[model samples]
Target: MLSDKERDQVRQTIEQQIAEAEKEMVVLKELTAAVAPDNSIGRISRMDAINNKSVNDAAYRNTRTRLKRLQNVLEKVDDKDYGLCMRCGKPIAFGRILILPEKRVCVSCSK
Candidate 1:
């Protein structure tokens, strides 16, 4: 269980993370834009560009998922079970929660 102060801290941290993730999503969306087929680049360079786009697309997806999880965690910040590990039903360490408020599992169960 977490005190009210700890919960507030986690809420603030999660909100900040959410804002950062949203900004990153916008940048990644630009990076993942379709590569023009008729570009004046060499074949190898075009291939490299395509590959980079694929990587950026994956990163964008991952960030989007994390953003959604953070939103969910923010909503649950005031709940009684907010800091409890989902795997073992133990209270997560306050330090760990401060660092990763979106995580639902503790260090022990995460292994």
Candidate 2:
């Protein structure tokens, strides 16, 4: 269980992370845009650009997933079991929750 103050702190941290993730998603969206086939770039350069776009597309998807998880966590912040690990039913460390509010399990269970 977490104290009121601790829960509040976790909520704020999660909110900050959400904002940062949203910003990163926007940047990644631009980076993942389709490479134009009609461009004058050499074959090798075009292939490299396509590869980079694929990487960025993966990153964008990951960021979007994280954003959704954070939003769900935000909604559960006031729940009595908010800080409890879903796997072990133990209270997750305050620092761990603050750093990764989207996680529903503790470090040990995550292994």
Candidate 3:
């Protein structure tokens, strides 16, 4: 179980990560828009742009997923089971939570 102070720290870190991911989402949206197909561009250049856009789109999706998970965790941060490993019911290390705020299982159960 985590002390109140520790939980507060985790909440603050998760909020900061959410803010950064939101900012990145905005930048990715702009990049995706800029890469839209243009007839004036050569076929090869257009193909490259399409590929870049695909990668950016995937990244944008991942960021959105991560943001959602973080927000959900933030809402549950004060719950009694918030820091417990979902699979093992053990207290997840604070360090691990700091590194992976969205983690729901411990390293042992992850195997």
Candidate 4:
């Protein structure tokens, strides 16, 4: 279990990540919108736009998923078992949480 100060720090970090993910999602939305199908461009340019849109769509999905996971972690930050490994019922290391705030299992249990 983490101390109150540590939990606060984690919360702040997750909040910052949420803000960044939201920003990225907005940018991805704009990028995908700009690549909308149009007859004004050549076939090759249209193909490139299609490719870029696909990539941007995947990135947008990933960013949304990340944002949801982070939000879930933020909700659980004050829980008694917030940092406990769900598989092993052990305390997850602070370092692991620092690097992967959405982690629910410890390294040993994850393997």
Per-residue lDDT of 36-101 in model 3, one digit per residue for the tens? 567899899999998999999999999999999999999999999988999999999899998788
lDDT (C-alpha) at residue 27 in model 2: 97
What candidate 2 gets wrong by more than 4 Å, as runs, is: none
Q: Tell me the TM-score of each prediction against the true structure.
A: 0.94, 0.96, 0.92, 0.89
**Inter-residue clash pairs, candidate 1:** none
Query: In model 1, how large is the Cα lDDT of residue 101?
Result: 87
lDDT of each: 0.92, 0.93, 0.92, 0.91
Q: How accurate is candidate 4 locally (lDDT)?
A: 0.91
- Candidate 4 local lDDT, residue 32: 83
Measured with C-alpha atoms, the lDDT of residue 104 in candidate 3 is 86
lDDT ranking from best to worst?
2, 1, 3, 4
The root-mean-square deviation over C-alpha atoms between each candidate and the true structure, in angstroms, is 1.0, 0.9, 1.4, 1.6
Worst 10 residues of 3 by lDDT: 30-39
Clashes of each: 0, 0, 0, 0
After superposition, the stretches of candidate 1 with alpha carbons farther than 4 Å from their true spots are none
lDDT string, candidate 1, 1-111, tens digits = 898988888989999999999999999999999998966897999999999999999999999999999998899999998899999999999889988888999999998
lDDT by residue (62-85, candidate 2, tens digit) is 999999999988999999999999
- Candidate 3 overall lDDT versus native: 0.92
